[model samples]
Target: MKLTLQILTLTSILLPLSYPIEFNYPSVFNFGDSNSDTGELIAGMGDHLDPPYGMIYFKTPSGRFCDGRLLVDLLMDAMDLPFLNAYLDSLGLPNFRKGCNFAAAASKILPATASDLSPFSFGIQVSQFLRFKVRALDLLAKGRKYEKYLPLQDYFEKGLYMFDIGQNDLAGAFYSKTLDQVLASIPKILEEFETGLKRLYDQGARNFWVHNTGPLGCLAQNVAKFGTDPLKLDELGCVSAHNQAARFFNLQLHALCKKLQSSFAGSNVTYVDIFSIKSNLIANYSRYGFEQPITACCGVGGPPLNYDSRIACGQTKVLDGSSVTATACNDSTEYVNWDGIHYTEAANQYVSSQILTGKYSDPPFADKMPFLLPIKF
Candidate 1:
């Protein structure tokens, strides 16, 4: 009996050890907007440096807009990869051996204006990647001591290329164009995205993970800005027109992903349905222990939204001849929206959990992905 028990214990340990590896992506090259900006925006524009931004995890502003890690950070943890350093980060020589992030806050597929915080468009980011590739390869060829900090040539072909932009492209249009006009503009925006993707493919990227835009109407900023008219509100108190636009954009984006998969031979292009996952989270916030679903945890004004365009998070601005500072809530964990526009770290963590489940992805992650680290609240 003792010999049999020892054999069973040994088998159990070996069985887990022999589990087959599935998605063994060597590196992840991320391209997106504010949703995945680790510190690129701060590096580029020198903004978002304030208290309450990285309070939960970093204990100080770490250039990320959230109180803790973003969706990209959580995904990296699950993949057993180090958090991606921003490509533009000039601070203390950033290591790029694993991967690099080209995402920037306020960036979009289309070109940005001079006044824009991140003038780096999707094309610009692609160009930056091209530049980085050349420079890093040169350093490695020279046998520089810092070559260890750069990615090998094969990593580009084997790495997973991730994208999570386009929300801002849709949101910005609402300010200047009618709903129909905004809907009409999606094809052009996606076409630009296609051009960038093709450029990357030419440079030899194979695995792709693309996230569609979320429910724009449900955002605290939009609810505060466009939800004044009761007729515009949907069943969930979100702007009906904005959500409609978002869904249309997502549908087109999904179709584009399908087209790209067929177009790029041997490329595994996976489109993740971020809209449904985020919508479900907002609709069922209470179930997930979130109280303020459509309210900003760190913004001005009160009640339904607590967001003010005049004053940013952690900024003191004069309103009605009096100064008011946009401070954080007592507990950020109970809120979904962080600074009217961005999501809280707690909310990002929840979204990451749902994504890893694979149900929200088109063609589903399923058994293909193995978690290296479990998500924590």
Candidate 2:
């Protein structure tokens, strides 16, 4: 009898603890621009996205700038969540159980980028999220049929809030203003970001994942636009000046993240270093199975790289009186860049892997408290 009891205890101890685990938040609320946008811009505005954009994966335009999925899509996949639907996508209204994407292509963190056509700035996106929360709360209070979809209480407080913005803001400042002016605007930009975070905190958001800007200089579009002299180019054929600016922005952002962590006692804020990951990819493309790191997979003109500033991806234009269409490469998986600005699905996949590896994220997500599960193992 003693031997049998010992055997049973050993069996129980040796058994693997495998069961379903719920995330801290039932849903993940994402906010950003083109980098994370699923289809918010397309739904809000018209269909600027055309063929060749999603040819590699979806076989049709899914309103993404890349040839396939964005980093956010890959992240969702890692989380075992469904692809987030754009909040503006009327057709996807029924699928908000997981969460909604509030990102808009070409939108900036600053209000200056807002126009009549593309008015969905970062601020506006946050406002929309606020409105969503309010409506969900109202439905729950009324004892409506939303309990199956929306969390009745503490949803916002529990949900993961991610931000992948600041690219457009820096781009706009760099192009429209002088270098010094652009540098000067960093504080203001960060200030707005801080304000947004505070607003979310006020509304019960505690978990935040913020991705810093990537190496802007290495983008084929930026290289084509700014890399005029060989001396200005890095070894990887990227504009060094633009990259410096990006680094500067990232440094300030890191400091800001630290400040936020201290200010918000209970909040879990993580700063993701996307710049380093992307830079490493550019430096060692072969390691990541990328044949072309500097050139775009879909573009029209090039001596250094095939990227036309005026003619965007999936568009035909008469350049030098010769009709040329921005075409996709035979294999997008071999290339790092899809268009001039966005990354290929493969590149995004690699980057997303790195992001989730807990190497680049501050305080590593795995080390954080796991989401509570009702069913205890």
Candidate 3:
């Protein structure tokens, strides 16, 4: 009952805070899925992408798969922090930057779930975060003007750690070589997440913007590509099983957060209800000026689809380049989703506005989200 009340109270508070507010987040260290990927995965994993992805931002794929700036880039600009650098981009310890996102294109909450994901698993992502931190410290000890390069601690004692994932865990798995043994692997995957959280807490990571999963079954990709029917389904479509799995993971995630807060004493945990925010975004895309809410903007098939689903980014595929296997929608900004599985930059902006403005951080996933409400506080 207490939990329910707390969630309700938080939700009420967020509803009003939806409008823009003045808030500054210094040095955001992102983790989790592709929602905040930026370009880390494409840069590190040879299996990831390169040029065509970033054409939106830098006229070439700086590893980003967008036609313009990403949510992180906007946040960085809002906070006055330099854009997040890919850890792999540094090439050496001396080039370390305070903000190097470790988010992969297909990262998951748990290691077990991520094993099937490409190079950027949760464990690997955490490691990369640590590695960058270690390297940052090395630069600090070297008496370099690290603060000038990546400033944040002076304004905010609580650094931002954005963790978003769980979507790919199910999607990638279903698409990958069959996983007849997946359902049994849930517990272990949850454990991996717990383990990583402990490590992060020990390393002085307090502020977290951990996102829950969104509606998976509703994605255009899942419906159009995975459905047996030939005439692909529209935005108002999805898979019940996949969405159920996402809900299950989120439940475990919240329980884990509660357990971690108690087990590892003296830690502040804020869990943001990204699942609800995203689901609502899709459900109410029309309210947000989105003409199409289910499909992607780069592919060909139809709503909730992508340019090409079979091949990983940057990797060429063998399909008849003309097949309607998948497609991209037009006017990404008009849609709540960029790809079936990911939200567009505009969507990210609105969600960020809601959370950062003290709108929903106290209820669910925002429970783990830092009180980024005050630009000064």
Candidate 4:
């Protein structure tokens, strides 16, 4: 009995809350790196040097790696929703059910980077969420209502969960390093991600929107630091190597999702092509009032986003033989790289708009897609 319970506990920690749908409003559950961080890092762990980071806008440091809101927060705002608190934070059991975001800065889908942060893994975050559900159940079972929160059983068939990670696992692993060592580990990493997805589906999650990766090589921090031709492109606005990898990942993700949808029979799964949309944004920043996509608004003096990957969530800069700030751009909205690795709030908004409006597919965005993904539904 003890051993069985332990195994279940370990599995619980490694899996996510795949709940059955039961509500109208989407519970904005997020999982990724700094791009969607929100105030979680401000809750601790990030070190953006304060003031100047969010100075131009927010007026106070919000854990975002920019002057204002992150993509997740902005999406919530666009949807007319509240900023999701972490599942483990101050808002007790009663308030958690509405929606909870479990993303942590520097967190990745790969387990190898797990050791870096107390060896934390992406699976652990999901497990923690399951435990939260258990807590809610316990609270209910004890005849103690947690502010009368609604249960999945009560809501039934209308909920949503957006999964955004994979980028950290790929980019972080090969930022300073090359994709040389990543080849062997890539499959395993992807397998782990697949496991997490299956776990979520098993838990009753009906509608899911899974976003794939973007062009990591083109991020301004990389081109500025590594010196890639910024404006040079083969009509697609993507460098040869970066787009190749991104395309491959997208293809695989698409296939995996297709298999899952067919295999699951009645599941409503949506695979969002964030890669193509992001590539379009970078390739056509000029269309959106930006002039550059190959440099970050804030980063240390060199490529791949400065700072040796040791520090995140702070002001970064570069100086040539003298002390001068190197991490910032004249205006963040004009550039695609926000602090080197993530996109700016504007970029995020644009992409979300693409996802919502209709600019993400082959031509008309969704016309080329095989399945009819209902964005409004």
List per-prediction Cα lDDT, in the order shown: 0.86, 0.81, 0.60, 0.58
Q: Could you tell me the lDDT of residue 64 within candidate 3? A: 61
Q: Report backbone clashes per prediction.
A: 0, 1, 37, 26
Q: Please give the lDDT score at residue 286 for candidate 1.
A: 85
Clashing pairs for model 2 are 24-371
lDDT leader: 1
Over 4 Å off, model 3: 1-26, 46-59, 78-80, 91-98, 110-117, 145-147, 150-157, 175-184, 229-235, 302-308, 311-330, 363-377
lDDT for model 3, please.
Answer: 0.60
Error of 1 at 362 (Å): 1.9
Q: Residue-wise lDDT of candidate 4 within 1-377, one digit each (tens)?
A: 12322333343345423224322444556666666666554454433346446654577765666766676775565445677665534533325555666776767776634245423356876776667656666676766455356344433224556677766666555555554564445667677877877776676666666777788667644444343465543354344545555666677777777777777656666777888788787777786667556656665645434423333435333434554443455566666667667776667656765665435532232332221122221
TM-scores of all predicted structures: 0.92, 0.89, 0.75, 0.75
* Per-residue C-alpha lDDT of model 2 across residues 1-377, encoded as one tens digit per residue: 12322332343345423235434466889999999999999988867697899886789999899988899987776566788889888874557767889999888888743343468888889999999889888888887687777655676787889999998888766667877788888899889888888988899999999999999999988888778888989888888878888898999999999999999979989999999999998999886567888899898785358889879888999988898898888888878898889998888867875675567988777444331111222
Winner on lDDT (1 vs 3): 1
Ranking by lDDT: 1, 2, 3, 4
Model 3, C-alpha of 278: deviation from truth (Å) = 1.4
Model 4: residues with Cα > 4 Å off, grouped in runs:
1-23, 41-49, 91-95, 112-120, 142-145, 148-157, 175-184, 224-240, 300-330, 358-377
Best by TM-score: 1
Put down candidate 3 lDDT per residue, 40-68, tens digits, no spaces. Answer: 76666654454335544477655665545
| Local lDDT at 320 for model 2 | 87
Clash pairs for candidate 1: none
